[model samples]
Target: MIPRVPRLQVTELVLDNCRSSNGEIEGLNDSFKELQFLSMANVELTSLAKLPTLSKLRKLELSDNVISGGLEVLAERCPNLTYLNLSGNKIKDLGTVEALQNLKNLKSLDLFNCEITNLEDYRDSIFELLQQITYLDGFDQEDNEAPDSEDDDDEGDEDDDDDENEAGPPGEYEEDDDEDDGASDLGEGEEEEEVGLSYLMKEEIQDEEDDDDYVEGGDEEEEAEGVRGEKRKREPEDEGEEEED
Candidate 1:
């Protein structure tokens, strides 16, 4: 329980891996008036309710929570929040993302291991929706591959044109080629090369994910272990006093 001081001056609070649930932190607002930075990561929170509305709050870390609703509440209650970490949640709704559009000052947002990250063009859509977000899921928009370079597009178009010239009613090219079999053979070889290049280009576009999305969830277990280790540490005096008694 937070002590009822005359005027609370506490600013930073780190309550990571506390096994906290919904509504458990509702009473904090009544105590901590000047609170700013808050970290409640891995707390098993399913809903973001009753969060203290400290307008001075600039950073919030609710990572690994089971938050499925109340994103709008955070955006509304903490309008001044600049950094938010919601990684490892099961937030599947895009509307939750739309809710964050109100956070005009939000600079960094982490949504790693969340279901929303699996959607098609997920990062692009989020980037378009939240222009103020500088870093998203541990990456910047600049890191994504360009749709297609101008040179690649020009080469693709040229290849398509060559294929179109070679492709016609089945016998049309054959009739033209009968007069000069050698020339026709050469043309066919070039057509094959063009088709092969076009196929490769298509493959490259499909492989765009290889360049765009970088998975980095390998250290999650280590982070959880660190949090647990912190929770298990005992005060040296408390441990030794029992032995003396």
Candidate 2:
């Protein structure tokens, strides 16, 4: 049956995994003038040239697609877009960050598991240009897939009882068996590496007059050593995340 477009009332549109190759975005424009959310994840679209025209779009997700379109087009078009997810694509360089300057209202950006090799390259200044954005996933990777759910939404208590029987008893967390890094304590004696070299200086010298060159150099050396140790620990976690990707 051919689906007729109703009067522009669509607030959310999801075409995920549609295997759509052509840019049929124009079809929706005629019927979805009020569209507030749009998703074409894992679909076969490459650019955001057609989307910026959607003046009412608030959230857009086009991840896992082969998009090489310059970030300039996205920034120019979706000026009002607040949430954007472009991870799992081939967007590598930080030029996109520059293009996103027009997205002054953007609140969240997900470039996680992407081609950004070192976050330090765009950590403070470039990212800060997006003043409205509060959260950004620098890793360029695909997000976790949610588990399956039964679609029988109108079931009554009888169905609940039947489901209970079919699913068996309730499950519980195996808390005792799940001990890894362990929780960090933050009370009286909570001095870890986060305390920094300043902690050692204050402990040894009670007054400000004791800031000797030897003590200052020692603090600098220890701080550098501590930073290296932290980086070493972080590298392994990054590798694990890569494996998960």
Candidate 3:
């Protein structure tokens, strides 16, 4: 009902586990321009082309669906999207992935049980093509085991909040612990040893990689533009490229 972009500004939306038929999907509009993250896993998504306008989507989950067509179109529409889940689909081959070279922001891609049994038989190296993907569905279990980092980060924030409350205010009389220690260098070593700099370094690396691309390439993106442009040109040259962002 509202203007297209503002309504789809929601970052997270999950419509997974819905067991409907093809008739469920109706119309898709430029409104989904606001979604940075979305999850429609386990839904009956036989035609993902319904969403032809969600250009700013950063994360998408369409695993366990019955997707058969319009994958390249989906990739073009979701160029900024970094995380994708195509697991548990009947997509038997790698036709759609070739067009994904345009997805420069794609970070994590899931393709578990996609009927791609003979992956080596394909022309493109599944891993080599998506070299940037840090997390792949069928493999890369160790990286995926990092779900606990979220919990640990939460605890650290909570502790910081508690300390802030006890400290009263920013300018309140609070003894600088280092002043009483006589020498700042004296305790810095101990703190570093206690916290384990190794762990901190690992966390930093993980954080850097957290938002890094899990997939790469952009030539495929140009192809997407060509395809989309064809559709718009057929309607009106003036409306060929609407400012989606």
Model 2 score (lDDT): 0.67
RMSD of each: 39.7, 34.3, 42.8
Please rank every candidate by TM-score, starting with the best. Answer: 1, 3, 2
Query: What's the distance in Å from true for residue 8, model 2?
Result: 0.5
Off by over 4 Å in 3: 1-9, 117-124, 138-245
Question: Lowest-lDDT window of 10 residues in candidate 1?
Answer: 143-152
Give model 2's clash tally: 7
Q: Write down the TM-score of every candidate.
A: 0.54, 0.50, 0.52
- The global C-alpha lDDT for each of the candidates, from Candidate 1 onward, is 0.78, 0.67, 0.68
- Candidate 3 lDDT trough over 10 residues, lowest sum: 141-150
Q: Report clash pairs, candidate 1.
A: none
Instruction: Write model 1 residue lDDT over 209-236, tens digit each, in one string.
Output: 5655433343666788888777667566
**Of the candidates numbered 1 and 2, which has the greater lDDT value?**
1
Candidate 3 lDDT over 1-245, as tens digits, reads 76654565665666767665672444446766676767778777787656756877777888788875567776667777767788788776666675676777766677777876457743236656766665565344344442423336889999999999987888655356546565677688788896798788889999777646432235567778999989876767545445442
